[model samples]
Target chain A: MRVALFASCLVDLFRPNAGFATVSLLENAGCIVDVPPEQTCCGQPAYNNGDKDNARDIAKQVINEFSDYEYIIVPSSSCAGMMIKHYPQLFEDNAEWYKKATDFSAHCYDLVTFLHDILKITSVPVTYQGNITYHDSCSSLRETRVKDKTRHLLACNEKINLLELGNPEACCGFGGTFCVKYPEISESMVNDKIADIEATGADTVVSGDMGCLLNIAGRLKRLNKPIKVFHIAEVLAGMTGIAAIGDADDTKKSEPSS
Target chain B: MKSKSHAFKQQAADALVNVSLQKALLNAKDGFIVKRKKAMDELPEFERLRTKAIEIKEHTLSHLDQYLEYFEQQVIKSGGTVHWASTTTQAQQIIVELCKQANARTVTKGKSMVGEEAAINDALEAAGFEAIETDLGEYIIQLANEPPSHIIAPAIHKSKQEIADLFKDHHKKYNFNSKLETIPEIVNEAREVLREKFINADVGITGANFLVAETGSTLIVTNEGNGDLTATLPKTHIVISSIEKVVPTLEDTSVLLRLLARSATGQEITSYTTFFNGPKRNSDIDGPENFHVVLLDNGRSNMLQNENHEMLKCIHCGACLNHCPVYSAIGGHAYGWVYPGPMGSVLTPIMQGLDEAKDLPFASTFCGRCEEVCPLSIPLPKLLRQHRNHIHHDKLNTSRSRLGLALWAFVASRPALYRPLSNSFIRALGWLGKKSGRFSWLPFASAWTQSKDLPAPAAQSFMSAWTQQQAKKKSSENE
Candidate 1:
């Protein structure tokens, strides 16, 4: 299968590894991935921030870039969900563009969902022996319904225990650009998210969106916790030995014995 | 002065940390949401009506001016006085003048959000007239000296225990209440109390759900039939509603009405979809002697010219509030406005100002639940994002966010600049963070680090890694 990668703006700049992990998983599943150099943002920030003019231009750029691809796969569920779910409505009045936007949405997939549900490639053909907990991103859980697909693929890891965090689908306070805009409230929400993770008794926290993982992991780092974080794609890509971040590297990472 | 869209973090934190308020809100939030959902689920045609409802609202908004004129003529033709209120103060002035004209001492009200928007109750009381809210929910909120938190259930933030306490404390003032027990008992007590006020009321004030332009008829749906009593028996009947509530015909009104009840309280249809065309007919046995319709424009016409014209299509179902995670967590008080939830987030900024209500839009998780469930199908999140974009241009955003945007925009605008910039940034953070495999508390990102650790970035970006793998494959094939 020929797929185009819409590596979200966050993954392209803040955390590139998630973008790479997504590519690795897709390629190993026998799909040829194409990274369009002409790509830009999906205008979610512009749209979310209420700038229709700029959002329109940015959305047009996305449509023009990937309109020809048979299928588009994205690393982050939030960004992908925006295009698939919201793009058609963005161009509602313009018949030609609206049709094109809807057509594009019909073919886009979030990485984990694409791998487990769409491609049906369960195993990474590699093993990882560790206990893990999954942190469900709000948009992915609510919009794309990524939890089941993410869990199905994770279950293929015979030696891993995927313990669920309390309020698994709660927002981690990294609501796109929400963290910086309302830092105080963001802290409270992430604090609650971290508390839930701590209660889970799992040393590693896995999530689909790098934006959420980064925000939660940032807070945990400040608190000096022993918990670790990784993108679901990296784990599903047979790349578990290289802990993404927050794990004690040389000091021996310990999973919860229970 | 909650901004149209503020950051969810600040708002949620402020709401959660308010111990007494949070405890009060927890029960009320669950009660309304669960009840409304159960009501909505019982009707299979509920979803079908949502689409038709949107169609009717859209139709009304597009021809609002024409319909408003038509409605006014109909009301006047039907022997009812039609008054246009350009502002809230103007609307209150007209209503008070009507009260004085009739020499009215007591007024009974039936759940009007437009009244809250107008601040009408204060004006009536200032004029030495008593205005009693007949709705149980509104009565509770009136006693609490708080704004109605939710649209349908006005005092939805109050618990049964808090309510019992409130009545116990205040019941003696009204000369009642030996004992009040159970939800049903409290409900009965309120019914008994309000029933007396209904008969004695010289004038009745109620907000109409929709006004039929062709007939100049006022339509209000209530389960308890308080609206009927409020509109009848009294010598004067006055309706305070925004100009946007006019529909061209009764058929059009019916279409919207079907969805309004289902989405709001999950009822198939409110028990009383009462329509009052004018004052008592020649042979009518029981009807008001005087009928008045107050058409309030106040910022609605301005919204018509703006991009939010679609928002006027809202039937005021309050479904958005019940489904919103942000609203569920904080309740309506934190919104600091009359309107709350997804609709409030969009409307507050426009009615207030973009600068003042900047945090309102940021309150949502952008979960799309509001958009999905709205009877009018308003693109609430899209409108909210527009508010934020406006804030960005005015430089109203905080220094941290503006800085974050500038930094991201600079590198992200170009791949060549972005690639190397990302490489060093990721590697440096990833390397430094590897001790315990993560660094606690990153400087400059203290707000984020305060709650969670930054996941160390991978040593490499996806682009370079993919390219490297391809090169290795080529070399292996060549060898």
Candidate 2:
């Protein structure tokens, strides 16, 4: 299978390891993974900001870049959701683009659902020894319905103990541009999320989306907490030897032995 | 009813720092979410019922004029008067006139958002008639002289201590001077105070959950049973509702009622779900002497013809508010309107001019949870996005953000330009923050750095590194 990876703009800039990990996992699943260099963003920021003309143009660009692939996979649920659920809506009035958009959306999947539901990979040959909790990004939990599929994969690793957050379904308030636009309320929300993560006593927290991971990890570091954050793809691909998100580069220097 | 929606940003900031309000919101958050889940989980037909309710509302709204006329005719047949008001001022005038004609001195009101929208209490008080709130939450906020912080739980922002203080201060006039300590004590005091007002009141006012066009009956579902008392105990009963509340039949109303309680409070049915057909009939023993239905348009007629027609399907259950993370964080008062949360964000802009409530639409994260939990599936986020589109088109949003988006979009749509531009910026930031892996503050990102540290970018962009890797792979293959 030929898979085009839409390593979201956040993953591309803020955390490249997650994108590389996603590529490794897809290759291991007997899929030829291609990272289309022309891709920049999924246009969520423009779309959610209500810049429809720009959003529409960006959507057309994204469609043109990845439409030829058998499957288009995104590591972040919100970006994938924008493509699969909202892209078609953006082109609804234009008959030709609407048809192309819908066809493009049908082939899109967020990474975890692609792996669990499509690839049917029950477990990965990876081991991580830690008490870890999961944060469900609002898009992942509600939009793509990515709950048990992620846990089902994570649970297959006997070395991983998944201690769930008190409210796993709650958003971490890294809502694309929401964190900056409404900084105070966003602070209170992410503070509540941090408290929930702390209550679990998990040394590490993992999530599928980079926006949430960045938000949670940034707050954790600011407060001088010892908790580590990783994208699920990084952990599942057995790439944990690299430094965790928002951690000093020297924190972990060894390579994965397996 | 006077919009503080314009001050939503400042109000939201203030709400965040309010210690007691935060506690109140935290305590109230999990109950609604958990209960609604359990209720839906137990009922296998809940999803099906939601679809049916939506269908019913769509049908009714499509023929709203015909159904409303039919409803009016049925009310006249039942010996009731139907008054139509196109604006809030007109609605207030109509209600005040009815009170004057009835020689009303004091009026008892059930929990009514329409009454809030019309500012009926202030209008009545200005007209020299005392209006008493009979619902416990409504009564508490009334005593505190504050707008309801929540629609269903009007005093949800108030802690028990605050309610006790209010009761202690206000109930002194009734010769009940003891400070209420327990939940029962607080509830019992409200019941006791309202009981006297219900009997002595010359006029009663309530909002309808649904208006059945076939029967001309007004339906109100309340856990407190106060709506029943407010609609029946007085000599005159006046139902304050919007035109969109009308449905074709009792069966359609029943479909909505099933979804309402479960979504609003997680009850299979409210403690009281009463229907009022009209005034007392000749064969009836006891009921209101006069019945009047004050159906207000209040921008809903415009809504019916526009993109916001789906919002009129809302039963005022407030399920969306209960599940909203923003509402949970700041509570409803921060939204600064009669309605709050996702629904209010959509409605306030349309009802109270777009410029007045511009920030309300942008206040949300567009998290999509509100639409997920809405029994009617109102697509709240889409409606909010529509408001943003309007704001953008009308240039109502801040020029700085608009310029920022335009600049970003220009580059983002051009991948060839965006790739290298983003690559260099990421590398520069990555080099700067290599030690800490984060920044406490940045030059242009103060809003983000204000509350939390901003995570630093990786040393190289993923696409840049991927290109390097691909070149290496191709060279090795050639070798």
Candidate 3:
């Protein structure tokens, strides 16, 4: 299979490891990968912030950059969802561009969905051992329907123990620029996300999107939490020799399980 | 009086901006959203109910002609009258005619989004009938001469102080104390004033939460019992609702009710989930002598046929409103519609023209809580996108917004120009924003920079770094 890698802007700058791991995973599955040289932000930031013009402009750039790819895969479900569902709607007026957007949407798939649905990579050869909790990013879990696929991919590592985070689909307050714009409500929402993470009793938390990782990690850092936060790709990649962040103590969650 | 949509937006903006109103809206927002989420989270049958509700709406809408005919027949057979209103004008005309026919001097109304949709009170008064809104929220706003700020809550935007003031000015004829400032006090005052209208009025006008075609009944679920009073007290009971309110069966209505109140107020059920099958059946002595259910189609029949038809599944729980950040920021009034928050954003464009109501969709943060907590699971953001898509395609993006998008599209599509240009742009912007790591002002970007800071981008773009990472990852794997 000829695959095009859409390592989202966040993965490129803030968390390159998830992006790299995705390329390695896809290549291991016997696929030819192409990295389009001109990819940029998906414009979700400007788009949601009433800067539709900037959003659409960036969307056009994104569409034109990888419009010709046969199989476009991304480590993040949210970005992939932006391409899959939102792009076509964004360009619904300009028939020519709308067609390009739809075609791009067809080629685009979230990493787990691409692995599970397209490649049929149910389980991979991986090793890990710990109680792990998973946070389902809202756009992917609900928008792209990546919940079970993501879980299945994580469960591929037989040595891993997957603990279900309370309210896994609850938003983590990273609504693009919303955290900065409405800092008060955003803090309140992230506070709830942290509380859920604390309830899971997992030494590590894994999520698919880098946007969420940064948001949750920032919250964890602020609260000075000891639990490690890693991208799902990093978890699927696994650590060979050393323990991951926050591995020293398996702090038990105080609450009785419901 | 302002249009229902504008009145809501203006009042909501006032509430959202005020420290006290913001505090109250925040309280309401958190209380409703949290409880609704917990209730939804706990329900194993909730997803199934959502699907069932969708199925009910789909079936009801697809066979609307048939179900409506059956419903009309049943209403007539059960000693009631059924009126078909194709437009708001027709609806108003029929209602006015009913008031004339019955010589109704007063009308007691229940909270109704459809009534808001029709602007029926204005018409009722134009026809010389005094329409008294009986729902406490509606009554507060009715005295203030404003629209319902929230669906279900109706007067969700108003504080008790506003209600107290409204009562002091409007109901002085009864010598009601102006000092009442509590929810219970206001409710009592509204009840005391409206009780006479309910008793002495020759007719009642209420909106149906759901119309059960299977049983030929109108269903209204309210905590305040205003809907029940409005439907039963007067000699003539008139149920007015949009065509989409109809469902196929009582079982379907039950499925929706289980989700509605929980999604609405976190109640297992509303205090009064009344199903008035018909009026004055021989066994029913305490009911209205004449029962009339005026089913209004308005723009809904057209909306029912569109790709965005899924919105009609809204049970008016206001779960979407309570969870919406924009709705929280501006309150229901800013959306400038009868249905405020996420649900109203979708409906306003369709009912009103897109050009007139372009700002509603842009108000959302695309946070997705509305979809998550919705009992019927309506994808609100997606529908909002439809409104924007129309606005965008037609070049109706807001005056300043159009030029910005055009420039962005121009620059982004051509990276040879965009990369170096944006890099330089970022560099200049970084210096401009160095004082606080944020820009207080920037040409064309001031709107954003005003509310929030535009963080400086990394020295390199993601594309350049991804290329470097890719080569390194591949070689390391090969080694």
Task: Give per-residue CA lDDT, model 2, range A1-258, as digits (tens).
Answer: 889999999999888888888998898899999888789899988888888999999999999999899799999998989999999999989999999999999999999999998999977866577899999888988789889888998987878899988887778888878889998888888899999999999999999999999888888888989899999998888788777888887854422221
Best by lDDT: 2
- Candidate 2 on B1-479: residue-level lDDT in tens? 69999999999999989999999998999999999999999989988998999999999999999999999999999999999999999999999999999999989999999999999999999999999999999999998889998889999999999999999999999999887899999999888989999989999999998999999999999988999989888999999999999999988988998899999999999999899999999999889999999999998988889899999989898899998899999989888889899999999999888999999998888888899999999999999999998898899989999999999999998888998899999989988988888899998999988877887877788888888888988999999
Candidate 3 lDDT over residue span B1-479, tens digit each? 23444344344445544786566675676678677767877887887888887787777878888888888787787888889899888999999898888889998888888888888999999988888898888888888877776887777667778778888888888887668868888778878888888888888888888888867898888888888888888888888988777787888888888988888888888888888878887776798888888888767778778878888777788888877756766666666666678898888878777766766665555768788778778889878866866777787665665665556656656768766776565546534533432333457644333333333333344455556656888899999
For residues B1-479, write the lDDT of model 1, one tens digit per residue. 22323444455667777766667765664565566667767767876777777777777788888888899899999899999999888999999999999899999998898898888898999999999888888888887778887888777768788888888886777787568779998888788888989989999999999999999998898887888888897999999999888988888887787678877887768888899899998998989989999989889999998988878988788988877767766778777677888898888888877776777877776767688778778888777876776777888877766676566555555557766777687668756765655555678766555555555554555555556666888899999
RMSD of each: 4.7, 1.7, 7.3
Candidate 3's docking class is incorrect
What is the C-alpha lDDT profile of model 3 across A1-258, one tens digit per residue? 888888776766544456656776787789887888787667776566445666778888787778777888988888888888878877777899888888889888889898889888866657667888888888876778988888788877887889897666567766665554444445556667788888988878888877777667665644567777777876776532222221221232211110
Q: Candidates ranked by TM-score, best first? A: 2, 1, 3
Better DockQ candidate (1, 3): 1
TM-score versus the correct structure, for each prediction: 0.85, 0.98, 0.77
What DockQ does candidate 1 score?
Answer: 0.39
Predicted complexes: DockQ each? 0.39, 0.74, 0.14
Each candidate's fnat, in order? 0.53, 0.79, 0.12
Best of the candidates, TM-score: 2
> Candidate 2 DockQ category?
medium
TM-score of chain A of 3: 0.90
Q: In candidate 3, which residue ranges exceed 4 Å CA deviation? A: A1-4, A9-34, A41-75, A86-137, A144-258, B1-15, B168-171, B178-183, B419-444, B465-479
